[model samples]
Target: MTFTDILREENDDVFQKIFSHPFVQGIGKGDVPKEALAHYIKADYEYLNAFMHIYGAAISKSGSREDIQYFNNQIDFVLNSEIHPHNNFCKHIGASYEELQGYPLPPTADHYVKHMMYHAHMGGLGEITGALLPCPWTYLEIGKELVKLYKPTVNHPFYHWITFYANEQVEETTLQMRKRLDDLASKASEKELEQMKIAFRKSCQLELAFWEMAYTCEEWPVRDYVKV
Candidate 1:
């Protein structure tokens, strides 16, 4: 099986949890609290900023013009298509980007983004792709599946969020990234392949935690007890 297939099979439990998680199910039912979305939107903006940086890092680290070109395209997609909509979500939710950025990263969010950064800084193409792959790919899967279950109307609270990831643009980008990972895997050493598998599995775990964080509007558990 392919690395992603193997990784997904191994972490199938996490994937199932993510899809069934209350936060995601909330979107399906149009009953999700706005407060939860408020917390999520803020942290998500921060996450997107990190994602953009990793894409830029991927460009500089890329060995070929084709890879650099793809990274440039991905960055453009994030900025032009994705980020603007995120800002709109912030506006609708009434969370200022300034406020969100200034807030400390929640623990799950911190671990997830930091892992992507670590691989972007340390790993080559396949490893970085493995680290980055879980977000868009899994979201697209969830989004597509959610839309089917919810059949959300135009006015649904999370309709835009649902449709955005469920649509062709995200699907196209995800497949391209997977194809890139496959190509990288073809030439990678067995040790490198193992690292990629590790990255993919850990990333899947983080994705599940991200949803749990959203459901609870999680902050660092120890924040209230600080000695300072």
Candidate 2:
């Protein structure tokens, strides 16, 4: 089996929890609250912005012209398609870019972005790929399953989000990343492989936390939330 397959097998339990999480299930059912979704969209925009930074790091770390082009193309896609559309969606739902920009990063979001940036900046190309692959990969996988489970209604608040992930372009991005990762795995030592697995697993866990945070509208604890 490829390293991607192995990693999936090893982390199956984590993915299961993520798939079963009420936040994700709500997407399939269209039962998630608008307030919860607004929180999620704001937070997800942060995640994608961090992803663009990671792509820049990947572009620098790539050894080959093809690899550099791959990251560059992904950078374009995220900026033009993923992030802009997201910002528009947020606006459509009453969350302006200015408002979202001013919002403090929740603890869950802060941790996830730091983990991704740390690996992209500090690790090799392989490690960077391992760290960043889960975002596109997870969404594509989840999107496909949701498509099968339910045909999205035209007015479904999450239809745009659903279709974006389920579309071929996102899956193509994941495939390219997986190809690069498998090539790296071929030359990696067992210890290095273990480290990749750890990074991959941590990303999956963070994704679950991200969804849970949105589902619960979790906010950073401060004087506002704490009893004096």
Candidate 3:
């Protein structure tokens, strides 16, 4: 089996939790509290900003024009394509995507982005891809699964969000990233491959935590203790 297949099999439990999370299920039923959706929109907007930076880091670490262009295209997709769903959801929730940009990254999101940044700064392309792969890939999995389970109609509150991630474009990008990682793994030393595995697993854990964070609207504990 391919390395990604291995990772997926191992991380199936976590992915299952993510799929069953209230936040995701709410999206399916179109009944999630607007506040929860607002929290997710704000936090995810910040998270995607950091996500794009990792792509930039990957471009810097790339040794080939092909790799650079791939990251560039992903950056464009994030900016132009991926966020359209966010914008649409924002309109429905009566929030401005532009205003959400200034909201602080929630604690879980901060930790998640730092995890990716650590790998991006300290490792090569393989490590960067390893850390980066979970975001899009897992969302694609969730999107596809949601569609299969819920059969969300066009009138579903998050129909665009669900369909956006489940679409061919997302699957294509995910497969391309997987192909890139598999290519990198083909030449990697065992030690390097193990590090990539570690990165992949940890990122999967973080992805699950991200859904929990959205469901809870997680905030810093310090904020509770230290009143302004």
Candidate 4:
């Protein structure tokens, strides 16, 4: 099996949790609360920013033009292509995308971003791919399953969001990343492979946590400090 297959098999339990998360299910049903979805769109907008930064880190560490191009293409896709769904959400909910971009990362998103950033800054290309692959990969899987489960129509509130992640373009992008990760794994040292395993697993766990966070509208439990 390819390295990504191994990673998916190892992390299947977490993937299942992410699939079954109420927040995700709500999207499938076209019934998630507008407030919850507004929170999610805002949080995800921030998450995509961090995701692009990791791609930048990957580009910096790339040893070949092809690798740099791959990362660059992904960065462009996230920056331009992914925003439409979020913009649609904002319009429906009357939320300002400008203000949404200004919101702070909630605790789970903060931790997840830091986790990927640490690997991006400190690890080799293989490890960076491992850390970053889960986001798009899982989203593709979730979107595909949601479409099958709900058979969403154009009238569905989240049809754009659901179909965006479920489409051929996303599937193609995910396949490219998986092939890239597998190629890197083939050349990696045993220690690097282990690091990749840990990064992949941790990312899957955090993916699940992100769903839970959105479902609950997660916020900091206590103020970091009181006003002077």
Candidate 5:
């Protein structure tokens, strides 16, 4: 099977566990803790900023003009739609852009962001896609859990909020990424393909770490500011 196939297969178990977690269930039922909700939103905003910065660099490095254009278009859409709208959402959640920007991120957040940049810099599109798979893919998997766990009267704003990310948005992004990866793999050299495999594994492992950190409320250097 191709690397994409392998990734989908490997992620199956992780996705199930994420959706089943009590925290995720709370989201489905619309009953998340206020603090947890705030943290999730803030962290996601910060991470998106970091992601776009790194993706911009990756697009610059793409060898093919077509790939470069694609990356640029994707980045543009994210900024105009995702990031901009998220900022507005934060306001609705009683948060300000300044506050979200000032809040500290966990160490895992930094590690995850850096990993994406590294892959983009060294691995081209296939490697970059491999590295990125964990983000949306993880959300998509966890979303399934939400669907299973959802309740009608939970009254949890955060639950619905998370659903937006993990379910609809994440699924859309994953499908687009899968297409991109297929395109890249078909054209990539054998060496590049091998690198993509390694990147995929590493990214998956990082994803596991990302969830563990989030679930356990682990604090790192960045956590100094954003206590869980």
Candidate 6:
């Protein structure tokens, strides 16, 4: 099976569990608490900011000159145009470009970021591509369900914000990752290629767990804006 197919099948299992949860199901349906939603909004922005930085680092370290340029251009656009602007959910949550500088990301967030950097710094280009694909790709999968279940409305900034990353950006990134993977896989050692597949799958599971933790928690300082 193709990398995209493998990722989709693995993500489907995790997305179902997250979407089936009461907290996730309630979002955008008027059941979520405003405070919880607010927290999520802020956290999501912080997360995105960190994500851009980490991915930028990976792009910088890529072996392929083209990969480096692609990631750099994408990162520049996201930081300057897409994410920097104080509009939409970022505006509603008071997450300005300046505030993003001081935002404190979750520890687990660092794990993913650092992991990508490590692979990019030490591993082949294909390995770095594999490492980066799971998170955005999984988010895209979940975002589709959220859109389906909780049609976007003015009141639901949280869902709307996430949908942007999941729909528009993730597809483009996934396509780039597939191209990188295919190109590198030919030169990659058999063991290294297998490891990349395993790492991608494990990362997908972690993404699911992160959502499950957010939904199952009783009190989240960051997600308090959304009422459970």
Error of 1 at 207 (Å): 0.8
Question: Per-residue alpha-carbon lDDT of model 2 for 43-94, expressed as tens digits?
Answer: 8777777888988998888889998898999889887888644663575566
TM-score of the candidate numbered 4? 0.95
**Residues 88-193, model 4: lDDT tens digits:** 6887788778877757788999999999999998899999999999998999999999999999999998899899999999999999989989999999999999
**Model 1 Cα lDDT, one tens digit per residue, 1-228:** 875666778878878888899988987776777777777877777887788899988998888898899998988888788864466456667677566564566789988999998988888878989988898888898989899898988888778878888999999999898888987898999999988988888899999998888778898767644545
Candidate 4's error at 100, in angstroms?
1.5
**Better by TM-score, candidate 4 or 2:** 4
Which regions of candidate 2 deviate over 4 angstroms? Answer: 84-92, 96-98, 223-228
Candidate that beats the other on lDDT, 2 or 6, i.e. the better one: 2
Tell me, by lDDT, which candidate is best: 4
Please provide, for model 3 over 1-228, each residue's C-alpha lDDT reduced to its tens digit, 9 standing for 90 to 100: 988888788889888988898888888877788777788888888888899999999999999999899999999998889778888679888888887776778888999999999999998899999999988899998899989999999888889999999999999999999999999998999988988988898898999898888888888877533435
Per-residue lDDT tens digits for candidate 5, residues 145-224, read 55555533335454444555555655777888888887789899999988887777777666666545555555663326
User: TM-scores of all models?
Assistant: 0.90, 0.90, 0.95, 0.95, 0.76, 0.70
RMSD of 4: 1.7
Deviation in Å, model 3, residue 118 alpha carbon: 0.5
Quote the lDDT for 146 in model 6: 73
Displacement of residue 213 (Cα, Å) in model 6 is: 4.8
TM-score of 2: 0.90
Return the lDDT, model 4, position 222.
87
TM-score head-to-head 2 vs 6, winner: 2
Lowest lDDT block of 10, candidate 2? 219-228
Whole-model lDDT for model 3 versus the true structure? 0.88
lDDT of 4: 0.90
- Model 4, residue 32: distance off in Å is 0.8
Off by over 4 Å in 3: 224-228
